[model samples]
Target: MRTVAEVARMIDHSLLRPELTTGDIETGCALAARYRVASVCVRPADVPLAATALAGTGVLVGTVVGFPHGGNATAVKEAETRLAIEQGATEIDMVLNIGRLRSGQLDDVEADIRAVVTAAASAPVKVILENAYLTDEQKIAGCRAAERAGTRFVKTSTGFADGGATMADLRLMRATVSDTVEVKAAGGVRSLDTLLAMADLGVTRFGATVTDRILDDLDHRLRDRDGWTAA
Candidate 1:
């Protein structure tokens, strides 16, 4: 049975909404600290704030590059990585250029990811696949590109897309990549049961804004002696 903290550790509290204020990022950081989540995934500009708020709290600071859409030039993405890292980001979740991949530009896609991976250097770089728009072949291709670029993780969804992570995609992504490349599922993981189900599919990390709700539900279920079964 997975305990509350066990599930909490897999979450990267998402604070990427463009409308959020600095106050919101600070509050989100506090929640991450309270739950001891894996990280606080924030906007690139908010990296410094999150880093300061999470300092010494053991929660790693993470930020996005190329954002919801992966249309940025390779050089720009690399520069974003450098700046975010200087601002205290330890992990970068970069979006893969979906258009390039769909256009059969696998080499370009791989190079785009490599640029960020190189800039991040020692920091872990997660390539966001934005699976909502890809075919199974396309998703498999995306996984191969990420692996070739040495991405630490291949993530599903940007949450801005038409759909989010699904069981089938999770299975495919986990199967295509070697064990060295971890998988992360973002979006629509709003409950304890859903999270556990994805974890069962070999996902090692998640991006979420509903951290408190899921953990609170898990805590309540445990208090009721209901075991790990979702309430």
Candidate 2:
């Protein structure tokens, strides 16, 4: 069984909802610090707030580029990435051009991701495929483009799509990317079992809003099963 910290590190506590206020970002940062989760994937405008709040807490600050819709021009996405990094985003979750991928324009798709990867400099980039809009062939192509562009991870969904991460999609993504490129599952990862199941499929990161519930349940289970206590 994974320890509380291990499970915590797997989560990228989500704070991207448009309606979230500054207070919500602060509260979310506090929770992330308390649990020592991997990072907080915040909205682009909230990067500075999250960065300041999480500073010295060891939790990374991540922001999205291109967001729910991946129709932003490549240069615009690149500019967004650069500005986000400037605003203290240590990690970037960028949405790939879903339409381009679906249209079979693999080269343009690859270039779009590469631009963000370039602008991110040293920051790790996770390319969101928004798999809900993609067929298996498009997903595979997206994964290949992300890999070829030197992204650090390929993610499923932005949580705004109709479908979230499914086992079928996770399996396909895991199989598509090489070992050097990790997989991230977003959407519908509200339970410990779901997170564990995705981890079993080689997912190393998750985006979730239910960070507290998931970690609390894991802590309880570990204590009951092994007399384990959180540090």
Among all candidates shown, the one with the greatest TM-score = 2
lDDT of each: 0.95, 0.95
Listed per model in order, the count of residue pairs whose N, CA or C atoms clash below 3 Å is: 0, 0
Q: Which stretches of candidate 2 lie over 4 Å from their true place?
A: 227-231
lDDT of 2 by residue, 46-98 (tens): 99999999999999999999998999999999999999999999999999998
Worst 10 residues of 1 by lDDT: 222-231
Q: RMSD for each model, in Å, please?
A: 2.3, 1.5
Q: Each model's TM-score, in the order given?
A: 0.97, 0.97
| lDDT of residue 150 for candidate 1 | 89
Model 1 has a clash total of: 0
Model 1 agreement with the true structure over 1-231: per-residue lDDT tens digits: 789888889999999988999999999999999999999999999998998999999999999999989999999999999999999999999999999999989999999999999999999999999999999999999999999998999999988889999999999999999999999999898988999999999999999889999999889888778545554
